[model samples]
Target: MTAPSVVVLDYGSGNLRSAVRAVERAGARVTLTDDFDAALAADGLLVPGVGAYESCMRGLRAIKGDRIIGRRLAGGRPVLGICVGMQILFARGVEHGVETDGCDEWPGTVERLQAPVVPHMGWNTVEAAPGSQLFAGVEDERFYFVHSYGVREWELVTNDRTAAPLVTWAEHGGDRFVAAVENGPLWATQFHPEKSGDAGAALLHNWVRTLT
Candidate 1:
């Protein structure tokens, strides 16, 4: 089978070069661009951010990639967000201010991780919920994380997993924050899969598997 095309978003907020390298190394044709049209043309979209949520969203808006990303998600295209990119997947973000009018407010609220520190940087274990395609063979694996804000639990928790409380843990500014979330074809993580070594590569591969 031919490998699918992957587009790693380069909106000037994250290490997109690293993400592109990782995707290419995983046997996918990779394109690093800030162009929304190019992003829409790819088989998969990886939105990676390594800074403030509001700033990342501003960067995305500057290039209209936010529009493209929102449209793609609504259309059922597979889109993945890393770190701050993940927090932007929500409906509102309290990073700097309320996101009353933007893509961040589309899914859920983005809030600071109520942990004991800021920029939760390091490896953290993530256990996949039942029936998540992004975690087909991944039960419990550690991924590198570095962020201060994330999507709240109510946003990603589903009907099937209602009984299972949404538990996302990461530290930021002496408070705990959400770490990961998923809704349909849209999945977000508060970590850097590319920096997670083999397990991270496997995550990219697993994301590609969901393209079909």
Candidate 2:
């Protein structure tokens, strides 16, 4: 069996290297590129982001990464997003009182956490969705989180024709936010699996295994 091919979308994000290395360690033949064709044709596409939501959105749009994600998902191809990459999948994001439109793949808004601390950093445990494939064996393990803004609510409404998404949640300073989401052909995590140690590796392996 061959390792799954993965494209770590390079849209000028600062943390691309770690993501690339992590995915490679997770049994993937990783390529970090902004090339539309390579990104689209890969067995899996990983979108990693850091910094402000607006800046991330601007960089992603500059290379038309948003459209690539949409096109890939429309074809039932797998796309995984991390950190601000995950936030941009929502409908909009309000950072420091200004709101910017997102990719709108999931209908929700990312906003500043209603926590005592702004950036909720450090390792934290997540309540993985019951049927989540990504958290298969690492359901009780902790993952790293470092974000101030996230989707506090998931607003996608599913009908009989569409299956509902599996959502994972995490809390900080009494405010709970979306930690991960497993929707058809689309999976994302608010934390950095690349930095999450052993548990993170298991989660990444779970996802990479799906592609193969």
Candidate 3:
């Protein structure tokens, strides 16, 4: 069997190398590229984001990454997003009172956390949704998180014709927010699995297993 091919979409996001190395360790043939065709044809696509939401979106747009994501998902291709990468999958995000439209893959607003201390950092446990393959062996493990903004509400409703997406939850300083999401053909995490140590590697491995 061949190792799955994964493209780490490099659209000027910060600290992309760490993600590239992490995914490589997860048993994938990783390629860090901004080429649209390479990203679209990969067995899996890794969208990593850091810094502000608007800036991330700008970089993604410049490389036509949004179109790449839309096309890939339309055909049921696997896409994994990390950090602000996950945040951009929502409808929009508000940071410092500036609102930017996201990929609109899901309906929700990424807003500041109501936590006492902003930018919830460090290891935290997650309530993985039932039947979550991403958390299969790491259900009880803690993952790393460093963010001040997140989707505080779960707004994607499904009909009987479609299975509901599995949503993960985590809390910080008395405020709860989305930690991860497992929608069909699209999986994302607000935390940086690449920096989460052993548990993160396990999670990435699980995601790599689902690639075509």
Candidate 4:
């Protein structure tokens, strides 16, 4: 089989180089592109973001990234979001008492974690949802994280019959937040897989295998 062609979107946020390298190491052909056409045509589109929610959303919008993501999902194409990239997929994000609208792919809000610490930095383990293809063999592993805000709870409705969408969780300072989510062709993680060492590499491999 041909190597999956993956696009690391250049939307002025996140560690584009690290993400591109990691995805390539996962056995996929990678492209770092700002072109909307190239992004839409790839086997997988990776949206990596760092910094505040509003700013990330601004950068994404500036490149018409939100539209690209929405269109990809509507067509059942694969898209992966990391850190703030994942956070911006929700309906809104509240930081410093301000709420900014998001892509609304999922009905929820990305707010500051109710933790004693401000930025929840370092490695953490995630309670992967049952039968999660993304965490299939690495359920006990930890991933690197660096953030202060995340989705504390999942509000999307998923029936028992169709279980394509699964929500994973993690805790820090007594606060539990959405650690990862796998919804149809859309997959996201609050942690940075590119920086998570071996465990992160395994997770990336799992995701890459899902791509055509």
Cα lDDT listed for each candidate: 0.72, 0.94, 0.95, 0.95
TM-scores across all candidates?
A: 0.83, 0.98, 0.99, 0.97
Count residue pairs with overlapping backbones in model 3: 0
Candidate 4 yields a Cα-based lDDT of 0.95
Q: On residues 15-83, what C-alpha lDDT tens digit does candidate 2 reach at each position?
A: 889999999999999999999999999999999999998999999999999999999999999999999
lDDT of 2: 0.94
Error of 3 at 106 (Å): 0.3
RMSD of each: 3.5, 0.7, 0.7, 1.1
For residues 1-212, write the lDDT of model 3, one tens digit per residue. Answer: 99999999999995689998999899999999999999999999999999899999999999999999999999999999999999999999999999999999999999999988998999999999999999999999999998999999999989999989999999999999999999999999999999999999999999998884
lDDT measured at residue 146 in model 3 versus the true structure, 0 to 100: 88
lDDT of 1 by residue, 126-199 (tens): 65666655555655777787766665456444467434433345444545455555566677777788898888
lDDT for each residue of candidate 4 in 156-199, tens digit (9 for 90 to 100): 88677866578899999999999999999999999999999999
- The residue ranges of model 2 lying beyond 4 angstroms of the native Cα positions read none
- Candidate 1, residue 20: the lDDT equals 87
